[model samples]
Target: MSDPNANRGLAGIVAAESALSFIDGAEGRLSYRGYDIHALARHAGYLEAVYLLWYDALPSAMELAVFEGTLAGQRELPAAVLEVLGRLPDASTPMAALRTAVSVLGQVDPEAEDISHEADLRKAGRLVAQLPTVIASFDRIRRGLEPVAPDPELGHAANFLFMRTGQAPGPTAARALDTSLLLYLEHGLNASTFTARVVASTLADIHSAVTAAVSALKGPLHGGANEKAMEMLLDIGSTEAAASYVDKALAEKRKIMGFGHRVYRTEDPRATHLRRLAEELSVESADTRWFELSRAVERLMLERKGLHCNVDFYCATVYHALDLPVDLFTPLFAMGRTAGWAAHVMEQHMHNRLIRPRAEYTGELDRPWVPIDRR
Candidate 1:
């Protein structure tokens, strides 16, 4: 029994006006700043997507080139930040490590206290540039391997992969990852984006707002869904088992990871692109197991439950085909989402307002307490 009158999760409430991204969940479409997401995911580079989200317009060719140089220039992490990453316990989750690393980055940044639009924009670019480095370095460090330095000549996705394995990614792999990052560039008022806006509403620095976003994304119902979804795929093991697993999981009243979204009434528009990318990568690697199994589950879920795959569904297989660890999936999410988080933070700062929502009281309205002697 629930109160029908109450807006239980603030599900339908419009919190603010934003021009960053738009979603027509009923139509299964998404766009950022008037650009179709399908177009961006298919053709735009991640850096280009970052520029679009931040600048409110698609950059001209020369602008994109200069933007690339500017963001790529900031890819190196502070040495103290590197030291912190190196000392974090091997058991540290990428999400936790990244959150801590971002906080440290703020302390080292001289402009961290500056919340002006110009300073925030610069900080945003720096964060987006450094996120992959932080995650890749942490991965290599925890594995007792020397971190490979960032390659300035490499594109964002390729540089991230290169920094991890000390090998430049091939065109196809790099494009797949770039497309995935572009697809994740923005979504309308998602948990992490909302968290970022809320913190920014208080006039917090970009780094502090982003750190809070990373923390919000650590929750399983949010960014961690892809990691859990991938683990579920691993547990299912093969295509033959996917249907039975889904059926059994449903019958037993268990939650299926990556099957639905909070906002989308139809399929997640981004999932379609990811499904294609996953298949391409799996075929390229001659490892079609995860991709095939993902399709099996996807079809079965649609047939049985009428639910659609969110952006995170096929993304599990896509990341696996790219050789990313399950645990790194969420941080990779945080990495891609940095663009949107920063954009939202800047937007909130531009229109400064503290986001204080009221809560309804459900307990007894009046109660009396006696003194200790009244026992």
Candidate 2:
């Protein structure tokens, strides 16, 4: 064991490097591949960003068509995978179901373990393209309804919303969801991606790496914060309730979910975009009550803890407006992040090196063990 003051969380540690995305926490800037996040979120669609992340450049018109065609083609889940999904409990969390499904998929695909550039890229594309469909399918099946098939005519973000609700999404909602996906798509060595790289460094298959990443993401401090944020909103009934409730929670030293971050001391850049989306969606839906409550909490949190809301804060409101369940928030994160996970897996494999880190020992050394009977 290391010393109690060793900072076991790896806080302030530089673990890895990447050229895919850059986050300057001090400057509050985020970029994907080479594109500015604000511009990409505002203008480029989700599929367009995914193409850039996976291929390392923006796609031309012809390339975009072929890329989207490939994604549309792979949208359908295997019947065997669907059969397994049907057996899962309805109350089962979507993230758990997603982890199981991704693992099960590895069993069904002969090339699931392939990590070659040519082979893995194809596999990555399929997984990335199918993520939204897979998440939607699990959500529908568990609710005792047939999964809605993906609509080829729909754009990536719009198709996902349509799959969940079986209706065309409004332009504003569609854009909000698309931007959210882009925001969550990639980050530098987050817990889940680190888990993925560690597994891939062992020469494990991409499916195994992704499965590990999913498991890491199940933690509350990570991908599950959005769900908790919604819960916090429901707990505090209104804007009036938010002020007192926040005070009590802070007095108890409880972490205000959707606020603060490990890396970004000022504010999460993604949160700025999501906050704008939440604010817009609130106006667009004419449901400003939740928005009011959220803002009240944000103001109090800043005053009390000097902490501001992260992406998960307003994202909860955005998802709520779209009628998504609270529990599905993190799974939605996983769906958006599948592309990044795959990209990270490819990066780890390209310059394949086993990721082995040393721990500073603090335990008793060379102690003789007493026989159990001696006790």
Candidate 3:
């Protein structure tokens, strides 16, 4: 048998090839479409980065205006999709609801299977355009509230917040949401993006590939960690409680949610930016309760596990302050990640590999058949 440690956790696995983002986990660095994540978070809006992810460069002035116009154009779902949204149970999870809606979208736009570059770009535009609508609609439906109409005057992030809350978000909340979306836009070969590429490699339709990705990303380890981080903080209750919780969790060898990452050994680059957003939102509100709880957990996790929070840690509090539902956190993740997935899909199709990998076999060798009585 091969050495067990030979592939510990599949660490350093080169899952796919792409001209997308590169993550230096050891250095806590991330870049998208060749721009540092810090710069993008500081300056760029979410849709701009999405354009870059798919098109390989930032848009020109006229291109930016045109792209924004296109996104504004497709903000409403067809009546059929809204009907499905109406039937979803109020208790349904957002990822499940989103997965269902994504499949249902195939029925609404039956032409989404067109794979030529021009055709794919059109579908990409539609998906990007409709994502906010789907998310906002699901948000209200699950909360027993009616979905609000989209406002074309608002930017992407502002429109999303406005649609969810029935009022305009302040500049600070809107910017934070925009940065959060940019931060979530891409990472190097994450599970869901890889899943999308795998399906795309098989020559499936883009909708089918994306649908596969949504299913893969539903796992707590992949996209649900942010919601889990919030739950952990509420369960901890206080700074004093945090210490005890850390002690017991460490003694039992249990993972503290949001404490460790598969890629980063020192810190998560995305966490740095999200931490700033959490602090900024706290400053804007002058309420530090959630921030303090998060800090306590961070301190305890580092002291106990020598690990730091990933993007999901402080983001929980940010979303909480925004009054977002816990279940929707991961779907929000998908809304942002769709950009990266689209980019990777284009890359996979252009450079066309089958993506077939061999498993290291360690099973019973071939043997002659025996009668049941002899066995």
Candidate 4:
């Protein structure tokens, strides 16, 4: 039998270091490149956050505008990739199609084999730019709707919303999404980010690294939390049932998808901002039902379990208020985290080292092999 005390998930293992993001789990503090997440979520656009993560500094006004333009220009998917998306089975999950599309994207990139810093950076930019297109295209194709072309006039988050719904998002909705993207920017060596770094360590192209990361994030324990949280609230249906729902879940020893974090002993800092945003958008749209239910569930969870909600909890209501389908939640998460994954990929390639860890042996020490035709 395997040793029960081994680091089953490599928890607390510091595999490598980079100047990416910091999380003070004990105090519920998070910052990216020395900037607090709260400030970024409130004041920065998603493009700015992407630049900061990749370049390690905030860009100037002209520089940011140039960055945005470059990304916008590259948002249109190649014809081959679009054909592939259309060819996929209609019932394919968004994440499954996204994973395949990203792989196909690598296959089509002329510089897919290049690992130099300059080439990697260009590919990274394309991943950030084209991911929204890939997602929106697959979604529309699966639903029997024509994919919308990228709108250069719109910012990154706003363009994604436009592509999804075929309508330009207003300032409040646009800013709300932009803030959420910044807030989801990155965390230190989470599963998907680590997966990106690991793949990049092999000198894989940025698209390959990003594809691996998306696959890792597709797991229910990771990226699916937000979707499950929304399902929970939707099932609960009202603030009146929130307490009982939580109570029953707790009494039955069911896992509450959004309450606990593997790293944070306190509430997730991102959740604080998302909680406010969820309510703001809810109130702005004159539909506070989801927000109220979220609050009630949050209060009950904290009171009974002494657990704090993570980023996924309030994000459910926030995305729901944005009128996003619950099924797209994880894909949206992959969309946000792709920037971070690319950043990690670049960092790993710059200081490449194969992340080969040892596995503990718990089987019999010297087992004699049986002959194939033993009597």
Candidate 5:
């Protein structure tokens, strides 16, 4: 018999055990392995965080160098993948293009059918290296420009900026981006991560799992929130209009994207760092309007709704200040989250299980079938 007390959307359900990340929702704390997120965000590089997520320990200096070198060596996409991106229509969204490219990568991978741990780790590293290239290539191609080749000398975050802009990022910009990527490296069983883990449980390749994760992330309620938040700011057009727009949105019961979270009763821990990045970048860019407006809306939302900002809220301004288009925001998220997704996939594969779950029946039981002629 099905339990009538089933949790809708699997709320409060512990689907699987993981050693990758821990979230204290009531306390508003997040950690990777046992390292606190704040400490990692402040002190660790993105690649270090990636290593920690994948291996469950921080890498030694020599190990990190080798890891970074291995990842950098894999940055170039398959020529066939680039050709595919070149042929995609200009209007194709970045997420769609990324999904297609990753699937194509699976097709071309030598060990595509290999489910072994070593092969999966290699595939994960390749994906981490190549996804930013895919995103940056698509962005440039769509704008009638050639893709910028990645600089091997730069680290992951800086290399991404260089690929996107064809120039090395300043220390501040690089650090801000590095911090953002580090902050987003992992979280506890987020929607997209769960999707990745679910696909992995089916014994799919890492690429397929990550491809499915990207699809899940394309939804507005997941990875698209930051892009929508940026749109809201742009729609308001000025700081002076922020309150009126927010008030009208509240009165109409429209969702104020980026202002709340499913798990965090207090503030999202990641938001604190992103909010500071937004402020820093805005000041450096000599345009504080977006950050100012974001703060205003945040204050109003809190006063009226008692909601706190999630990671997506201030990230809109930060990315905007970096001159990234709104559409690419989610792809950037996928790039950062690739590490976490791959980690979850690895974890799921290590402890294999089919993820099938029962649905509670709500319809008439054992209904008699009628013949078509009789009916």
Candidate 6:
């Protein structure tokens, strides 16, 4: 029998072993494949980070060039997929559209039924390449604009921005987005990653696993926090309003969207890089209100609640400064995290096991069954 005192939500439970990423919550440290996140965010590009997560090691220069070329080549979507995106209602949320689009991609993929490790890896590369394109295209289509084609010359982050806005991003803006992607690429057995692993363990194909992962991420407690955080900032509107808004929210016991985290006791390490990026982007845009307001809220939250900022808090300001639509924030999160999900899916497949856990039943021990016609 399972212990009655087993942790709720499986908190602190080590269900499976992985070499993909590790989180040291006590020290607020995170690493992917034994490489520190700070080092990757500072020194590596988004593609490089994705390569590391997928291949379990950083690629050499020649290897990286070929890998990047393959991804760029796969960026073009099938016409049928584009048509599906175009037909979706403007009222559709980006995450919902992405989920549907990914499902369609699975249906159309020639190799969707392939379950071999080599085939799964190829699919992973295709997903990493194609997700940004899908997201950028849907954003443009919903705005009644034609989708821009991917530029072969641009790297992943720059290419995404270019596609979304029909103009190439400046170096600073592109780099900021790249760093944010690195920060979001992977975490240790997060809800969506676990979802991916669970699905993969059932011997499902890569597309199915990724689709399941996307569904899990669409939940508010998982990927929707960043969108909520951005909404909160817009609600506050100014530095002067931030403290009192926070005070009122706190007095009413309202949950602050981005202040606390499930794992990190201190500040999220990803937030450290994002906070700086937010400040820098805000400065470059010559509108510092969002960053200043965020800082004021940060101060108040810490003074009263001792809760430090998580990755979502500063990313709201950063995305705002980049001129990204607030609604697309979670889809952007899905784009970055596709790499991690693919990696976990592959890893789970490599070491196959059905992830089945039992619940301690508490509702009825000896209750008599009631008939349908009972009076």
Kindly list the per-residue Cα lDDT of model 2 for residues 118-169, writing each as its tens digit.
7778888778767788788888887778889999888788888888878889
lDDT of 3 by residue, 1-375 (tens): 778678665678887767788888889888987899889888889989988888888999889889999989888898988999889876777788888887788667857666777766777777777888899998888778999999999999899999998999999999888888889888878789889998889876667777888898888898888888888888888777888887887899877778788888888888888888898898789988888888888987887668899988888888877778787788888888877777777777777778888778777888899999999
Q: How accurate is candidate 5 locally (lDDT)?
A: 0.90
Put down candidate 4 lDDT per residue, 1-375, tens digits, no spaces. 676776779888789898999988998899999999988888888999899998989999999999999999999998989999999987889999999999998999888899999998898898889989988888888888999999999999899999987999988888887888787779989999999988888787898888899999988789899999999999999998888888899999998888899899998999998999998999899999999889998888889989999988888888999999888888888888888888888889988899878777666777788999994
Instruction: Give per-residue CA lDDT, model 1, range 1-375, as digits (tens).
Output: 358577877898999889999899899989989999888887888889889889888899999999999888999999999999988887899899999999999999879899999999999989998999999999999888998889989999999999999989899899988888888888989888899999999898999999999999999898999999999999999999888899999999888899888889898999999999999998888888889899999999899999998999888888898899899999989999998999999999999889989777667856788799996
Q: Candidate 3's error at 207, in angstroms?
A: 1.3
TM of each candidate vs. truth: 0.97, 0.96, 0.95, 0.97, 0.97, 0.97
Model 3 residue pairs with clashes: none
Candidate 6 residue lDDT tens string, 1-375 = 677777988889998899988899889999989999889888999889888888888999999999999999999998889999999986899999999989888888878998788888888888889999999999999888999999989989999999998899999899999899889899978899999999889898888888888889887788888889999999998888888899999999998888898899998999999999999998888999899998998899999999998888888889889999898888888899998998888888889999999778867587788998994
Give Cα-based local distance difference scores for all models. 0.91, 0.86, 0.83, 0.89, 0.90, 0.90
Model 6, runs deviating above 4 Å: 1-6
Residue 127 displacement (Å), model 3: 1.2
* CA-RMSD of model 1: 1.5
Evaluate model 6: give its lDDT: 0.90
Pairs of colliding residues, candidate 2: none
Off by over 4 Å in 3: 89-91, 367-375
Give candidate 2's error at residue 313 in angstroms.
0.8
Q: Indicate the worst ten consecutive residues by lDDT in candidate 5.
A: 1-10
Clashes of each: 0, 0, 0, 0, 0, 0
